[model samples]
Target: MTKSRPNILLIYTGGTIGMVKDFETGALKAFDFKNLLDRIPELKHLDCDIETFSFAEPIDSSNMNPKYWVEIAEIIESNYNLFDGFVVLHGSDTMSYTASALSFMLEHLAKPVVFTGSQLPIGDLRTDAKENLITSIHVASLQHFNEPVIKEVTLYFEYKLYRANRTTKINAEHFEAFASLNYPDLVTSGVHLKVNTDYLFKPNTKKRFKVNKNFDTNIALVKLYPGISEALLRAVFSTFGLKGVILESYGAGNCTTETWFLNILKEAILNGIQIINVTQCSGGSVLMGQYQSSELLLKLGIISGKDMTTEAAVCKLMYLLGQNVSSKVFKTIYETSLRGELT
Candidate 1:
């Protein structure tokens, strides 16, 4: 008897990785996915069947929005039975945001959905595209006893594989562009692939996979700075159609305890606006009640997005709002970890 090879789907949604430089003109142009195997001959060595799906009109990661997220989820849902795993080629600029959004959007995912892209174009002399693309495919194809080792949405960059929602793009010029500050990496690629099985997210095998396409984008992120004006704060809270706000407060979720500030926030909460307290610092969890400044926020129904990346908080708010979850239970659910995004 012969063993069957896994089938991996390669989704090209546009980015630096999909570009090739013209040798004579020195201009970059989109590379056709039809010639994928020819350009990267090493893919032929992988023990898996690969298929390609290119977006009709590729957009940069900056233009990435909830509609595109839904499109990606729909593609995976439509082909769930046909492919064993998926690799999404995206721009690194907003890759973390897209990855974070997808993590919540795809519930009960049991197969790998690996997102990867390079800082430099594929045709560049020092291009990181080939390695990132190849390694992501390998990571996506990984399985043990016919079950995938990584059964979640993950971002593969440089040599590290991080849970999608846990990652933040920390650099613009380096090949290593992302950092999973609060969570340990899932895998590290080297001479041999090393997977940290203990940190992997295990999905419920009994539940069926479903895609949630309804995302309410009526949200705002308010990053608190020293001497931030009351007018500015009021304007943000009063944004038309704003249903939720992710307040990037000072260290450990501290904010001005000034009476006016608290009143503004109190009014917002009273008007049914969900305010989530997330620390502006990169790596620490939000201990809302630890400081005097944050105590008022905690008492006034502010949800603590403990240690969750801002990207995850924004997407999670959009998802929860779309679910039309009752305002009474919103704070409890948002504070709790639903997709390993919060500690």
Candidate 2:
């Protein structure tokens, strides 16, 4: 008996990883993905049948939003049955955001959805795109007992594979551009691929796979700074149709205990604006009520975001708001880890 090769789909959403330099103009341009296999001949040697799909037009990651997030989810849903795994080539700028969004969007996802990109263009002499792309596909194709090994959305960069919702883009100029400070890396690539199987997500295979395309963008993310004024907080709460706010607070989700600041947040919670307290630090959990300052947040019924990155918290808020969960349980639901995003 012999094993069969996996069928991996390469989706080029947009990124510097798939660009080629135009020598005459000295500017990088998006290359024709139809020639993807030609540029990366090494892909032919992988034990998988590869197919490529490109968006009609590439988008810069800075402009990434919920609309594009829905588009990506639909693509995966439509092709779910045909492919064993998916590798999304996306810009590193918002790769963590997109990865986090998809983790919440896909329900009962039993196959790998790996996202990867490079800091430098593919045509660069010292490009990192080839390694990232090749390894991502290989990771997506891993199997055990004729079943997929990675059953969650993941972001692969430089040489590490992280749970998508646990990742944060920590650097803009380095090859090792992403980090999982509060969580462990799912996979690490070196001389041999070392998978931390204990940390992998396992989905309920009995349930049918479903795609969640609806995402409400009526959300605000505000960071707490010294001497922050009331007017700015008022402006955010006053935004028409604003449904949620992800408040990035100081260490352990603490903020100024001033009466004015507390009143504004209390008012928002009363007015049905879901306010979440996530820590500003990159490497810790939000432990509301652990200190006197954060005790006020716990008393105000502010939802704790725990260990989730700001990128993940933002997407999770939008996703949950779109689901229209009632205020009575919204706080409880957000505090729970729907996608292993928080502790």
Q: Top model by lDDT, which number?
A: 1
Q: Candidate 2: list runs displaced more than 4 Å.
A: 1-3
Quickly count the clashes in candidate 2: 0
Write out the backbone clash pairs for model 2. none
Give me the displacement of residue 99 in model 1, in angstroms: 0.8
Candidate 1, lDDT over the whole model: 0.93
lDDT digits (tens) for residues 11-95 of candidate 1? 9999999999999998999999988999999999988989999999999989999999999999999999999999999999899
Candidate 1 matches the true fold with a TM-score of: 0.99
Error of 2 at 215 (Å): 0.8
Model 1 alpha-carbon miss at residue 62, Å:
0.8
TM-score of 2: 0.98
